[model samples]
Target: MFPPLCCDSGVDQASRRRHHQSRKMAMLSFWRDGLERQLAAVTAAMDTLQRQIDRDAQSDS
Candidate 1:
């Protein structure tokens, strides 16, 4: 009975570790996706501003 209990404990610990790892991976993916989206938005805004600046300079010339 004692040996069986030890084996069971090991199995439970392994399963818990896997669960924690999966959760960490999920959170990392979520943050990464959010960062990518924000970066894309910033880049698009920059492009628009740059284009406007160019247009303004050309008009002045």
Candidate 2:
């Protein structure tokens, strides 16, 4: 088992748990934002490629 970080009373443990949860939520939010931006960029690039393909198909016809 992992060693205890500190000698935590009930109130101290509750406070520490809340602090950890808040930090974890903030980190998740940061990752979600980065992923959203990446997805948007990928979608835009795909759209551009699709347009180019359509243009080439029309020219070939």
Candidate 3:
């Protein structure tokens, strides 16, 4: 009889899982940073538009 061949050992599987989780966390962190940057840009634009509107209203008065 022949012994069964396995793809990965227990240690190897655990290491791979840890590596996958780390990569996933890194990706999530990157996306979170990108979203935060976009939000900041949008907020700044809105503030600028509000200031302009206020100026225009004051001039009209």
Candidate that scores best on lDDT: 2
lDDT of 1 by residue, 1-61 (tens): 0122234454677786676688889999999999999999999999999999999999999
**Comparing candidate 2 with candidate 3, which one achieves the higher lDDT?**
2
Off by over 4 Å in 1: 1-11
TM-scores for all candidates: the values are: 0.75, 0.78, 0.77
> Weakest 10 consecutive residues, lDDT, candidate 2?
1-10
RMSD, every candidate, angstroms: 7.7, 3.3, 7.9
TM-score of 3: 0.77
Clash-forming residue pairs, model 2: none
Which is the leading candidate under TM-score?
Answer: 2
lDDT of each: 0.81, 0.85, 0.83
lDDT string, candidate 3, 1-61, tens digits: 2222545665577777677688889999999999999999999999999999999999999
Weakest 10 consecutive residues, lDDT, candidate 3?
1-10
